[model samples]
Target: MRAAVFTALCISLSAGAHVLLSANPLPLGMLAALSAGVFAVAFLLAGRRERGYWSIAALLVPLELAADTVFTTGQHTCYGQSGGPVAGSMRSLGLDLLCSGEFGTPLARMTARGEALAGTAASPWLLLGAHVGVGLVAAAWLRRGEAALAGLLRAAAAVAFRPLLLAVAIVTVAPVRSTGRPGRRSDRTRAARPRPHLLHSVLRRGPPCPAAA
Candidate 1:
């Protein structure tokens, strides 16, 4: 019942991306974005409700790929002026190799040429790859019912979904400066450091560890 409701909501949301999505007639990029969101949320809810993260995770792969493909495949033109559904999506997606915006957001931008309609800002492929990798791990975790494995997956997801979560947090609630949080005091000291010296050192050597003082 929960899964049903969850799936329904996804479909409803995606309908906007799909219906409004288009290069020529169909809004493929929008559709794909909507689909990705729906599947991601659906899988998460289903996993929790049925206690079958693996099952949901398995289905999540194709759903993600399909959403990615749909949005990517029709986003841009390959050899022509504009995309023709398939080619457009493909060309749009291929651009992601250079950048990483799956949902047409900023962090995904490498070149100013990346268009929002194309949904070429984020790397849907990277995201899809991570999902695939996690799914494999989930397979093993399910068999052993390892709570540790579950925790590991949760940690990975927390990190993986940080960008999305952060965006939501920032948009919905402005980022608040740390309130004397632990180690936060060092933030000011760190900021006051000589940038040139730090840059030269970093350039000469990789990230430094000053534990020895």
Candidate 2:
């Protein structure tokens, strides 16, 4: 429960930040804008793991609205003319709610064309489906991806230790080739060579021993 609350708070803050930064006239880079969605999904997965597909389905709308509200608050957005005064400058629940009819958002405009909610034209229902579908797909994909992730980790470990393994193999084989065989042969030859005769040495000194008899 605490994990889920923390995840939700983080997701909301990130989403709000994205909204606030996107309104800046200066280009803030793509990651600054899209990072919220990426982080939100990551937090969702971390909080729920393989369970709670329903939570994702349920939270998508509220999250979107919350982000939209962040964008709308204190924002001055014009409808059509660029140089004209801002049309919807008052406090709003974002463009999705405040701007409509002639000043509608793209989705609202598309929906106003009598296009079916489930048709090729974009609508809230289509957006909802896409959002939920992506979340569900991500959950399913990650659930089944454990083996692949483990294999990748194993492969990385093997690559990291490859040089060490090569060094070990070289150490094991090099001594035998360079010195091992020659040292054994030298020992055998040294053992095989005849030693000086002990009897000959004694005989050379024996003439002095006969006087003792």
Candidate 3:
């Protein structure tokens, strides 16, 4: 019961976030803008500038993933669900814009589309299936995209910011790279240096030679 209430509260808050976004677009926009900006700034400040380009490119991948998550969620919660009956489903469908955007949170999502009543979930699976179906179709269409820029953008996204694949790869490879230190300590240390952190602590001195000169 407590968990459900908490969930409902959270959903309500999320709904408010979307609805009230105009009240504070600055913060959200700033964060999003900064994520992209810092990625570029840090890259330029570093010697390995190419890495920066790739890192900035990689940032797009997450934003794409976020878009997919939002879109699918909206489709499921707002458009595709079955309600109490066909009539209810029809009514609920009418509320898509509000449900998908203004009230995109769980509490706002109806078990039925109507307020002041328990929402009837049309079919969670059905909603999920529709989302997946649309995703696959969109993916296929995207594959056949006509615009060169679109194709290039997609390709670059996949390479620099591949979602599921990139996430899993990072998790799997990070630990292995970190833990399985080499039989040869120096070489391994050198490899780890750039990836993890700078190694040397102190500055080298040539005071005697300078004094003699």
Q: Give the range where candidate 1 is weakest over 10 consecutive residues by summed lDDT.
A: 98-107
lDDT of 2 by residue, 129-168 (tens): 5444444554444334544655687899999999999999
Q: What TM-score, to 2 decimals, does candidate 1 have?
A: 0.29
Every candidate's lDDT = 0.48, 0.43, 0.38
CA RMSD for every model? Answer: 28.7, 12.8, 23.6
Instruction: Quote the positional error of residue 40 for candidate 1 in Å.
Output: 12
Candidate 1, residues 95-153: lDDT per residue as tens digits?
33422223322222433432454455454454455546644554454435435556778
**Which candidate has the top score in TM-score?**
2
Q: Return the TM-score for each candidate structure.
A: 0.29, 0.31, 0.21
Assess candidate 3 and give its TM-score to the true structure: 0.21
**Tens digit per residue, CA lDDT, model 3, 97-197:** 33422223343342232232213354334334444444444334333432344557679988876687877888888444455544688776776675644
Lowest lDDT 10-residue stretch of candidate 3: 21-30
Which candidate tops lDDT? 1
Name the lDDT value of residue 204 in candidate 1: 57
